[model samples]
Target chain A: MTGGSELPIASNADVVLVRQQVRSAALEVGLSLVDQTKVVTAASELARNALVYGGGGMARVEIVENGPRKGLKLVFSDEGPGIADVEQALTDGWTTGGGLGLGLSGSRRLVDEFDLVSAPSKGTTVTVTKWAR
Target chain B: MERVPILKLGDILIISIQIDLEDQSVLALQEDLAEAVVAHSARGVIIDITAVEIVDSFIGRMLATIAAMSRMLDAQTVVVGMRPAVAITLVELGLSLGGVRTALNLEKGVALLDHVRGATP
Candidate 1:
Protein backbone atom coordinates (compact mmCIF):
# COMPACT_ATOMS: atom_id res chain seq x y z
CA MET A 1 0.00 0.00 0.00
CA THR A 2 1.14 3.54 -0.68
CA GLY A 3 -0.04 7.08 0.07
CA GLY A 4 -3.76 7.88 0.38
CA SER A 5 -6.14 10.47 1.77
CA GLU A 6 -8.72 10.40 4.55
CA LEU A 7 -12.14 11.91 3.94
CA PRO A 8 -15.20 12.53 6.09
CA ILE A 9 -18.54 10.96 5.42
CA ALA A 10 -21.00 12.95 7.48
CA SER A 11 -23.37 14.36 4.90
CA ASN A 12 -24.96 13.80 1.50
CA ALA A 13 -22.33 15.90 -0.25
CA ASP A 14 -19.60 13.84 1.34
CA VAL A 15 -20.88 10.80 -0.49
CA VAL A 16 -20.44 12.56 -3.80
CA LEU A 17 -17.02 13.75 -2.75
CA VAL A 18 -16.07 10.22 -1.79
CA ARG A 19 -17.04 8.91 -5.19
CA GLN A 20 -15.02 11.58 -6.95
CA GLN A 21 -11.96 10.97 -4.84
CA VAL A 22 -12.20 7.23 -5.34
CA ARG A 23 -12.60 7.70 -9.06
CA SER A 24 -9.39 9.73 -9.26
CA ALA A 25 -7.54 7.25 -7.09
CA ALA A 26 -8.81 4.35 -9.16
CA LEU A 27 -7.64 6.12 -12.28
CA GLU A 28 -4.28 6.76 -10.70
CA VAL A 29 -3.95 3.06 -9.92
CA GLY A 30 -4.36 2.25 -13.64
CA LEU A 31 -7.67 0.45 -13.33
CA SER A 32 -9.65 -0.02 -16.51
CA LEU A 33 -12.65 2.20 -17.19
CA VAL A 34 -15.15 -0.39 -16.05
CA ASP A 35 -13.07 -1.27 -13.01
CA GLN A 36 -12.81 2.37 -12.09
CA THR A 37 -16.57 2.78 -12.36
CA LYS A 38 -17.18 -0.30 -10.25
CA VAL A 39 -14.84 0.86 -7.49
CA VAL A 40 -16.25 4.36 -7.50
CA THR A 41 -19.80 3.06 -7.35
CA ALA A 42 -18.90 0.73 -4.52
CA ALA A 43 -17.24 3.56 -2.66
CA SER A 44 -20.35 5.66 -3.08
CA GLU A 45 -22.57 2.91 -1.67
CA LEU A 46 -20.30 2.25 1.32
CA ALA A 47 -19.89 5.93 2.08
CA ARG A 48 -23.65 6.44 2.07
CA ASN A 49 -24.09 3.37 4.19
CA ALA A 50 -21.72 4.85 6.74
CA LEU A 51 -23.60 8.14 6.73
CA VAL A 52 -27.15 6.80 6.88
CA TYR A 53 -26.89 3.55 8.83
CA GLY A 54 -23.72 4.23 10.82
CA GLY A 55 -24.56 7.85 11.73
CA GLY A 56 -21.50 9.22 9.94
CA GLY A 57 -17.90 8.02 9.69
CA MET A 58 -14.47 8.36 8.07
CA ALA A 59 -13.20 6.98 4.75
CA ARG A 60 -9.57 6.10 4.10
CA VAL A 61 -8.80 5.62 0.43
CA GLU A 62 -5.50 4.05 -0.52
CA ILE A 63 -3.62 2.75 -3.54
CA VAL A 64 -2.47 -0.80 -3.02
CA GLU A 65 -0.17 -3.18 -4.86
CA ASN A 66 0.44 -6.91 -4.81
CA GLY A 67 3.38 -7.93 -6.99
CA PRO A 68 2.99 -5.92 -10.18
CA ARG A 69 -0.83 -5.64 -9.91
CA LYS A 70 -2.15 -2.36 -8.56
CA GLY A 71 -5.53 -1.68 -6.96
CA LEU A 72 -7.63 0.75 -4.94
CA LYS A 73 -8.65 0.14 -1.34
CA LEU A 74 -11.31 1.93 0.67
CA VAL A 75 -12.00 1.72 4.40
CA PHE A 76 -15.14 3.22 5.85
CA SER A 77 -15.59 3.29 9.62
CA ASP A 78 -18.50 4.66 11.63
CA GLU A 79 -19.16 4.95 15.37
CA GLY A 80 -22.84 4.14 15.24
CA PRO A 81 -25.00 1.15 16.18
CA GLY A 82 -23.02 -1.74 14.77
CA ILE A 83 -24.56 -4.60 12.90
CA ALA A 84 -24.95 -7.87 14.81
CA ASP A 85 -25.59 -10.41 12.07
CA VAL A 86 -22.96 -10.16 9.39
CA GLU A 87 -24.34 -13.00 7.30
CA GLN A 88 -27.90 -11.72 7.25
CA ALA A 89 -26.67 -8.23 6.62
CA LEU A 90 -24.79 -9.37 3.51
CA THR A 91 -27.84 -11.05 2.11
CA ASP A 92 -29.49 -9.43 -0.88
CA GLY A 93 -32.66 -7.41 -0.31
CA TRP A 94 -32.19 -7.44 3.46
CA THR A 95 -32.19 -3.98 4.91
CA THR A 96 -32.70 -2.56 8.40
CA GLY A 97 -33.18 0.85 6.88
CA GLY A 98 -35.89 1.16 4.21
CA GLY A 99 -33.38 0.89 1.36
CA LEU A 100 -33.55 -1.70 -1.44
CA GLY A 101 -31.05 -3.62 0.72
CA LEU A 102 -28.44 -3.72 -2.02
CA GLY A 103 -25.78 -1.61 -0.37
CA LEU A 104 -23.70 -4.30 1.33
CA SER A 105 -24.34 -7.19 -1.02
CA GLY A 106 -24.12 -5.06 -4.12
CA SER A 107 -20.93 -3.40 -3.02
CA ARG A 108 -19.44 -6.82 -2.41
CA ARG A 109 -20.32 -7.81 -5.94
CA LEU A 110 -18.66 -4.72 -7.37
CA VAL A 111 -15.28 -5.16 -5.71
CA ASP A 112 -12.65 -7.89 -5.58
CA GLU A 113 -12.49 -8.17 -1.79
CA PHE A 114 -14.99 -7.26 0.92
CA ASP A 115 -14.66 -7.28 4.72
CA LEU A 116 -17.11 -6.19 7.41
CA VAL A 117 -16.47 -5.89 11.13
CA SER A 118 -18.96 -4.66 13.68
CA ALA A 119 -20.83 -5.55 16.85
CA PRO A 120 -23.46 -4.11 19.10
CA SER A 121 -22.26 -0.74 20.49
CA LYS A 122 -18.84 -1.30 18.94
CA GLY A 123 -19.23 0.73 15.74
CA THR A 124 -18.75 -0.65 12.18
CA THR A 125 -15.86 -0.78 9.78
CA VAL A 126 -16.06 -1.94 6.17
CA THR A 127 -12.99 -2.46 3.98
CA VAL A 128 -13.12 -3.17 0.27
CA THR A 129 -10.56 -3.50 -2.54
CA LYS A 130 -10.68 -3.68 -6.35
CA TRP A 131 -7.62 -4.65 -8.36
CA ALA A 132 -6.89 -3.84 -11.97
CA ARG A 133 -7.20 -6.66 -14.47
CA MET B 1 -26.69 22.14 -3.61
CA GLU B 2 -26.81 22.47 -7.38
CA ARG B 3 -30.12 21.98 -9.16
CA VAL B 4 -30.35 20.17 -12.50
CA PRO B 5 -32.13 22.10 -15.15
CA ILE B 6 -35.26 20.74 -16.82
CA LEU B 7 -36.09 21.95 -20.33
CA LYS B 8 -39.44 21.65 -22.10
CA LEU B 9 -39.80 20.69 -25.74
CA GLY B 10 -43.22 20.33 -27.30
CA ASP B 11 -44.83 17.60 -25.15
CA ILE B 12 -41.61 16.25 -23.77
CA LEU B 13 -39.74 17.41 -20.67
CA ILE B 14 -35.98 17.05 -21.12
CA ILE B 15 -33.42 16.88 -18.30
CA SER B 16 -29.75 16.60 -19.20
CA ILE B 17 -27.80 16.03 -16.02
CA GLN B 18 -24.35 17.61 -16.43
CA ILE B 19 -23.02 17.63 -12.88
CA ASP B 20 -21.81 15.08 -10.38
CA LEU B 21 -24.98 14.88 -8.31
CA GLU B 22 -25.23 14.82 -4.56
CA ASP B 23 -28.05 12.92 -2.83
CA GLN B 24 -29.93 16.13 -2.20
CA SER B 25 -29.58 17.17 -5.83
CA VAL B 26 -30.94 13.83 -6.99
CA LEU B 27 -33.99 14.27 -4.74
CA ALA B 28 -34.38 17.82 -5.92
CA LEU B 29 -34.25 16.69 -9.55
CA GLN B 30 -36.98 14.16 -8.90
CA GLU B 31 -39.17 16.80 -7.27
CA ASP B 32 -38.46 19.29 -10.02
CA LEU B 33 -39.20 16.77 -12.78
CA ALA B 34 -42.49 15.80 -11.15
CA GLU B 35 -43.50 19.45 -10.96
CA ALA B 36 -42.45 20.08 -14.54
CA VAL B 37 -44.50 17.14 -15.75
CA VAL B 38 -47.57 18.53 -14.05
CA ALA B 39 -46.98 22.13 -15.02
CA HIS B 40 -46.29 21.43 -18.68
CA SER B 41 -48.77 18.57 -18.91
CA ALA B 42 -45.94 16.75 -20.65
CA ARG B 43 -46.68 13.38 -22.07
CA GLY B 44 -43.05 12.22 -22.08
CA VAL B 45 -39.93 12.80 -19.99
CA ILE B 46 -36.45 12.23 -21.38
CA ILE B 47 -33.58 12.21 -18.90
CA ASP B 48 -30.21 12.42 -20.63
CA ILE B 49 -27.51 10.95 -18.42
CA THR B 50 -24.76 10.85 -21.04
CA ALA B 51 -22.51 12.86 -18.79
CA VAL B 52 -23.27 10.98 -15.59
CA GLU B 53 -20.39 8.65 -14.81
CA ILE B 54 -21.88 6.59 -12.04
CA VAL B 55 -25.27 5.06 -11.16
CA ASP B 56 -24.96 3.58 -7.73
CA SER B 57 -27.94 2.14 -5.86
CA PHE B 58 -29.01 5.57 -4.63
CA ILE B 59 -28.94 7.16 -8.08
CA GLY B 60 -30.35 4.00 -9.60
CA ARG B 61 -33.26 4.08 -7.17
CA MET B 62 -33.77 7.76 -7.95
CA LEU B 63 -34.11 6.91 -11.67
CA ALA B 64 -36.65 4.20 -10.98
CA THR B 65 -38.54 6.53 -8.67
CA ILE B 66 -38.68 9.19 -11.32
CA ALA B 67 -40.00 6.71 -13.87
CA ALA B 68 -42.73 5.49 -11.51
CA MET B 69 -43.61 9.02 -10.46
CA SER B 70 -43.84 10.22 -14.05
CA ARG B 71 -46.12 7.35 -14.92
CA MET B 72 -48.59 8.37 -12.24
CA LEU B 73 -48.36 11.92 -13.51
CA ASP B 74 -49.39 10.71 -17.01
CA ALA B 75 -45.91 10.91 -18.51
CA GLN B 76 -43.59 8.26 -19.86
CA THR B 77 -39.93 8.54 -18.75
CA VAL B 78 -36.82 7.31 -20.59
CA VAL B 79 -33.24 7.45 -19.34
CA VAL B 80 -30.65 7.93 -22.05
CA GLY B 81 -26.89 7.91 -22.72
CA MET B 82 -25.69 5.67 -19.91
CA ARG B 83 -22.00 5.00 -20.30
CA PRO B 84 -21.06 1.37 -20.89
CA ALA B 85 -18.99 1.21 -17.72
CA VAL B 86 -21.82 2.65 -15.69
CA ALA B 87 -24.22 0.04 -17.05
CA ILE B 88 -21.86 -2.81 -16.21
CA THR B 89 -21.32 -1.48 -12.71
CA LEU B 90 -25.06 -1.08 -12.11
CA VAL B 91 -25.79 -4.66 -13.15
CA GLU B 92 -22.95 -6.05 -11.07
CA LEU B 93 -24.28 -4.02 -8.17
CA GLY B 94 -27.54 -6.00 -8.62
CA LEU B 95 -29.71 -3.12 -9.73
CA SER B 96 -31.84 -4.13 -12.70
CA LEU B 97 -33.85 -0.90 -12.75
CA GLY B 98 -36.86 -3.09 -13.53
CA GLY B 99 -39.52 -0.58 -14.50
CA VAL B 100 -37.32 2.05 -16.04
CA ARG B 101 -37.01 2.40 -19.83
CA THR B 102 -33.65 3.32 -21.33
CA ALA B 103 -32.42 4.44 -24.75
CA LEU B 104 -29.05 4.89 -26.34
CA ASN B 105 -29.07 8.66 -26.58
CA LEU B 106 -31.23 11.74 -26.13
CA GLU B 107 -32.68 11.60 -29.62
CA LYS B 108 -33.55 7.95 -29.33
CA GLY B 109 -35.03 8.53 -25.91
CA VAL B 110 -37.27 11.24 -27.30
CA ALA B 111 -38.25 8.95 -30.14
CA LEU B 112 -39.09 6.18 -27.71
CA LEU B 113 -41.32 8.45 -25.66
CA ASP B 114 -42.94 9.72 -28.84
CA HIS B 115 -43.56 6.22 -30.07
CA VAL B 116 -45.05 5.12 -26.77
CA ARG B 117 -47.23 8.19 -26.54
CA GLY B 118 -48.41 7.91 -30.09
CA ALA B 119 -49.22 4.22 -29.82
CA THR B 120 -51.12 4.70 -26.57
CA PRO B 121 -53.66 7.32 -27.79
Candidate 2:
Protein backbone atom coordinates (compact mmCIF):
# COMPACT_ATOMS: atom_id res chain seq x y z
CA MET A 1 0.00 0.00 0.00
CA THR A 2 1.41 3.33 -1.09
CA GLY A 3 0.20 6.13 1.16
CA GLY A 4 -1.44 9.10 -0.52
CA SER A 5 -2.36 12.60 0.64
CA GLU A 6 -3.81 13.50 4.03
CA LEU A 7 -7.01 15.47 4.68
CA PRO A 8 -7.81 17.21 7.95
CA ILE A 9 -11.23 16.91 9.48
CA ALA A 10 -12.27 20.10 11.19
CA SER A 11 -15.90 20.96 10.66
CA ASN A 12 -18.79 19.51 8.70
CA ALA A 13 -17.48 21.08 5.50
CA ASP A 14 -14.29 19.07 5.66
CA VAL A 15 -16.45 15.98 5.76
CA VAL A 16 -17.58 16.78 2.25
CA LEU A 17 -14.00 17.32 1.19
CA VAL A 18 -13.01 13.97 2.67
CA ARG A 19 -15.75 12.23 0.76
CA GLN A 20 -14.55 13.88 -2.44
CA GLN A 21 -11.01 12.66 -1.88
CA VAL A 22 -12.19 9.17 -1.00
CA ARG A 23 -14.39 9.06 -4.09
CA SER A 24 -11.49 10.09 -6.31
CA ALA A 25 -9.27 7.45 -4.76
CA ALA A 26 -11.90 4.80 -5.43
CA LEU A 27 -12.21 5.94 -9.04
CA GLU A 28 -8.46 6.14 -9.54
CA VAL A 29 -8.37 2.48 -8.56
CA GLY A 30 -11.23 1.76 -11.00
CA LEU A 31 -13.82 0.70 -8.42
CA SER A 32 -17.39 0.30 -9.65
CA LEU A 33 -19.97 2.95 -8.91
CA VAL A 34 -21.51 0.94 -6.09
CA ASP A 35 -18.11 0.27 -4.61
CA GLN A 36 -17.15 3.92 -4.94
CA THR A 37 -20.26 4.97 -3.09
CA LYS A 38 -19.60 2.48 -0.31
CA VAL A 39 -16.07 3.70 0.34
CA VAL A 40 -17.15 7.33 0.12
CA THR A 41 -19.95 6.72 2.59
CA ALA A 42 -17.68 4.90 4.98
CA ALA A 43 -15.13 7.70 4.79
CA SER A 44 -17.79 10.26 5.50
CA GLU A 45 -19.00 8.42 8.57
CA LEU A 46 -15.51 7.90 10.00
CA ALA A 47 -14.50 11.45 9.19
CA ARG A 48 -17.50 12.75 11.09
CA ASN A 49 -16.55 10.64 14.07
CA ALA A 50 -13.05 12.04 14.01
CA LEU A 51 -14.45 15.52 14.17
CA VAL A 52 -17.41 15.05 16.45
CA TYR A 53 -16.08 12.44 18.79
CA GLY A 54 -12.30 12.67 18.53
CA GLY A 55 -12.28 16.47 18.59
CA GLY A 56 -10.83 16.68 15.07
CA GLY A 57 -8.19 14.62 13.25
CA MET A 58 -6.90 13.79 9.78
CA ALA A 59 -7.42 11.06 7.21
CA ARG A 60 -4.94 9.48 4.79
CA VAL A 61 -5.69 7.46 1.70
CA GLU A 62 -3.62 4.97 -0.24
CA ILE A 63 -3.66 2.64 -3.20
CA VAL A 64 -2.54 -0.92 -2.46
CA GLU A 65 -1.53 -3.40 -5.15
CA ASN A 66 -1.32 -7.12 -4.51
CA GLY A 67 -0.17 -9.10 -7.55
CA PRO A 68 -2.99 -8.53 -10.02
CA ARG A 69 -5.41 -7.18 -7.41
CA LYS A 70 -5.76 -3.62 -6.13
CA GLY A 71 -7.30 -2.10 -3.02
CA LEU A 72 -8.01 1.27 -1.36
CA LYS A 73 -7.12 2.05 2.24
CA LEU A 74 -8.29 4.88 4.48
CA VAL A 75 -6.71 5.79 7.78
CA PHE A 76 -8.42 8.19 10.20
CA SER A 77 -6.75 9.35 13.38
CA ASP A 78 -7.67 11.77 16.15
CA GLU A 79 -6.17 12.97 19.41
CA GLY A 80 -9.01 13.74 21.71
CA PRO A 81 -10.67 12.22 24.75
CA GLY A 82 -10.55 8.61 23.65
CA ILE A 83 -13.32 6.12 23.80
CA ALA A 84 -13.69 4.23 27.08
CA ASP A 85 -15.25 1.17 25.51
CA VAL A 86 -14.38 0.24 21.95
CA GLU A 87 -16.72 -2.70 21.74
CA GLN A 88 -19.76 -0.73 22.90
CA ALA A 89 -18.92 2.10 20.54
CA LEU A 90 -18.88 -0.29 17.60
CA THR A 91 -22.26 -1.70 18.50
CA ASP A 92 -24.89 -0.96 15.89
CA GLY A 93 -27.26 0.98 18.15
CA TRP A 94 -24.81 2.72 20.44
CA THR A 95 -24.28 6.45 20.11
CA THR A 96 -23.46 9.24 22.51
CA GLY A 97 -25.09 11.64 20.10
CA GLY A 98 -28.57 11.73 18.66
CA GLY A 99 -27.65 9.58 15.70
CA LEU A 100 -28.80 6.00 15.12
CA GLY A 101 -25.35 4.70 16.19
CA LEU A 102 -24.42 3.10 12.85
CA GLY A 103 -21.17 4.92 12.25
CA LEU A 104 -18.49 2.50 13.43
CA SER A 105 -20.06 -0.85 12.77
CA GLY A 106 -21.61 0.33 9.53
CA SER A 107 -18.29 1.54 8.20
CA ARG A 108 -16.69 -1.68 9.35
CA ARG A 109 -19.27 -3.64 7.37
CA LEU A 110 -18.57 -1.65 4.20
CA VAL A 111 -14.84 -2.22 4.13
CA ASP A 112 -13.12 -5.58 3.62
CA GLU A 113 -10.66 -4.94 6.45
CA PHE A 114 -11.12 -2.82 9.57
CA ASP A 115 -8.92 -1.91 12.50
CA LEU A 116 -9.58 0.43 15.44
CA VAL A 117 -7.45 1.35 18.42
CA SER A 118 -8.10 3.78 21.26
CA ALA A 119 -7.06 4.67 24.79
CA PRO A 120 -8.79 6.65 27.51
CA SER A 121 -6.82 9.88 27.10
CA LYS A 122 -4.58 9.17 24.16
CA GLY A 123 -6.63 9.08 20.93
CA THR A 124 -8.05 6.73 18.32
CA THR A 125 -7.11 5.50 14.88
CA VAL A 126 -9.32 3.61 12.44
CA THR A 127 -8.05 1.98 9.26
CA VAL A 128 -10.10 0.27 6.61
CA THR A 129 -9.51 -1.27 3.18
CA LYS A 130 -11.74 -2.16 0.29
CA TRP A 131 -10.39 -4.28 -2.55
CA ALA A 132 -11.52 -4.20 -6.14
CA ARG A 133 -13.28 -7.29 -7.44
CA MET B 1 -25.51 30.90 6.03
CA GLU B 2 -26.27 29.17 2.73
CA ARG B 3 -29.90 28.11 2.49
CA VAL B 4 -31.71 25.77 0.16
CA PRO B 5 -34.91 27.26 -1.17
CA ILE B 6 -38.31 25.85 -0.36
CA LEU B 7 -40.94 26.25 -3.05
CA LYS B 8 -44.63 26.24 -2.38
CA LEU B 9 -46.55 24.19 -4.92
CA GLY B 10 -50.18 24.63 -3.97
CA ASP B 11 -50.64 22.76 -0.72
CA ILE B 12 -47.24 21.11 -0.85
CA LEU B 13 -43.80 22.46 0.00
CA ILE B 14 -40.98 21.23 -2.25
CA ILE B 15 -37.37 21.30 -1.08
CA SER B 16 -34.63 20.33 -3.48
CA ILE B 17 -31.17 19.63 -2.09
CA GLN B 18 -29.24 20.52 -5.22
CA ILE B 19 -25.80 20.94 -3.72
CA ASP B 20 -23.44 19.33 -1.26
CA LEU B 21 -24.84 20.15 2.17
CA GLU B 22 -22.76 21.11 5.13
CA ASP B 23 -23.97 20.63 8.69
CA GLN B 24 -25.06 24.24 8.98
CA SER B 25 -26.90 24.15 5.66
CA VAL B 26 -28.70 20.96 6.61
CA LEU B 27 -29.81 22.46 9.91
CA ALA B 28 -30.91 25.63 8.16
CA LEU B 29 -32.98 23.57 5.73
CA GLN B 30 -34.67 21.83 8.62
CA GLU B 31 -35.62 25.12 10.27
CA ASP B 32 -36.70 26.72 7.03
CA LEU B 33 -38.84 23.74 6.15
CA ALA B 34 -40.65 23.93 9.43
CA GLU B 35 -41.33 27.63 8.94
CA ALA B 36 -42.43 27.16 5.34
CA VAL B 37 -44.80 24.40 6.23
CA VAL B 38 -46.50 26.62 8.75
CA ALA B 39 -46.39 29.76 6.57
CA HIS B 40 -47.89 28.14 3.49
CA SER B 41 -50.28 25.94 5.41
CA ALA B 42 -48.79 23.08 3.46
CA ARG B 43 -50.42 19.69 3.69
CA GLY B 44 -47.59 17.77 2.08
CA VAL B 45 -43.83 18.05 1.59
CA ILE B 46 -41.47 16.63 -1.02
CA ILE B 47 -37.68 16.67 -0.66
CA ASP B 48 -35.82 16.11 -3.92
CA ILE B 49 -32.46 14.45 -3.40
CA THR B 50 -31.75 13.42 -6.99
CA ALA B 51 -28.77 15.73 -7.11
CA VAL B 52 -27.48 14.43 -3.81
CA GLU B 53 -24.82 11.80 -4.37
CA ILE B 54 -23.85 10.93 -0.80
CA VAL B 55 -26.09 11.02 2.27
CA ASP B 56 -24.09 10.13 5.34
CA SER B 57 -25.65 9.19 8.64
CA PHE B 58 -25.98 12.86 9.57
CA ILE B 59 -27.97 13.82 6.48
CA GLY B 60 -29.93 10.57 6.64
CA ARG B 61 -30.93 11.38 10.20
CA MET B 62 -31.86 14.88 9.14
CA LEU B 63 -34.20 13.51 6.49
CA ALA B 64 -35.85 11.12 8.93
CA THR B 65 -36.17 13.83 11.55
CA ILE B 66 -37.64 16.27 9.06
CA ALA B 67 -40.20 13.68 8.00
CA ALA B 68 -41.20 13.10 11.59
CA MET B 69 -41.41 16.82 12.26
CA SER B 70 -43.54 17.40 9.19
CA ARG B 71 -45.70 14.47 10.10
CA MET B 72 -46.45 15.91 13.51
CA LEU B 73 -47.64 19.04 11.73
CA ASP B 74 -50.10 16.98 9.68
CA ALA B 75 -48.08 17.15 6.46
CA GLN B 76 -47.15 14.04 4.55
CA THR B 77 -43.52 13.84 3.44
CA VAL B 78 -42.05 12.11 0.40
CA VAL B 79 -38.40 11.87 -0.60
CA VAL B 80 -37.75 11.63 -4.29
CA GLY B 81 -35.00 10.89 -6.80
CA MET B 82 -32.54 8.91 -4.68
CA ARG B 83 -29.88 7.51 -6.99
CA PRO B 84 -29.37 3.78 -6.83
CA ALA B 85 -25.83 4.30 -5.62
CA VAL B 86 -26.97 6.61 -2.85
CA ALA B 87 -29.66 4.15 -1.86
CA ILE B 88 -27.08 1.42 -1.51
CA THR B 89 -24.91 3.73 0.51
CA LEU B 90 -27.78 4.70 2.78
CA VAL B 91 -28.60 1.07 3.38
CA GLU B 92 -25.00 0.18 4.00
CA LEU B 93 -24.82 3.12 6.34
CA GLY B 94 -27.47 1.21 8.32
CA LEU B 95 -30.21 3.83 8.29
CA SER B 96 -33.56 2.53 7.26
CA LEU B 97 -35.17 5.98 6.90
CA GLY B 98 -38.30 4.11 7.73
CA GLY B 99 -40.56 7.00 8.71
CA VAL B 100 -40.11 8.83 5.43
CA ARG B 101 -41.81 8.17 2.10
CA THR B 102 -39.92 7.95 -1.17
CA ALA B 103 -40.60 8.00 -4.91
CA LEU B 104 -38.74 7.63 -8.17
CA ASN B 105 -39.09 11.32 -9.12
CA LEU B 106 -40.79 14.54 -8.24
CA GLU B 107 -43.84 13.71 -10.33
CA LYS B 108 -44.48 10.46 -8.56
CA GLY B 109 -43.48 11.92 -5.24
CA VAL B 110 -46.06 14.68 -5.48
CA ALA B 111 -48.67 12.17 -6.56
CA LEU B 112 -47.80 10.01 -3.56
CA LEU B 113 -48.14 12.93 -1.22
CA ASP B 114 -51.55 13.66 -2.64
CA HIS B 115 -52.61 10.06 -2.41
CA VAL B 116 -51.43 9.77 1.16
CA ARG B 117 -53.12 12.95 2.20
CA GLY B 118 -56.27 12.02 0.34
CA ALA B 119 -56.70 8.71 2.13
CA THR B 120 -55.69 9.90 5.58
CA PRO B 121 -58.11 10.56 8.44
The per-residue C-alpha lDDT of model 1 at residue A45 equals 90
Q: Candidate 1: lDDT over CA atoms?
A: 0.93
Ten contiguous residues minimizing lDDT sum, candidate 2 chain A = A1-10
Question: In terms of docking quality, how is candidate 2 classified?
Answer: medium
Q: What TM-scores do the predictions have?
A: 0.98, 0.96
> What is candidate 1's DockQ?
0.92
True-structure lDDT of candidate 2: 0.90
Candidate 2 residue A63 Cα shift, in angstroms, is 1.3
Candidate 2 regions with alpha-carbon error over 4 angstroms: none
lDDT of each: 0.93, 0.90
Q: Which structure among the candidates has the greatest TM-score?
A: 1
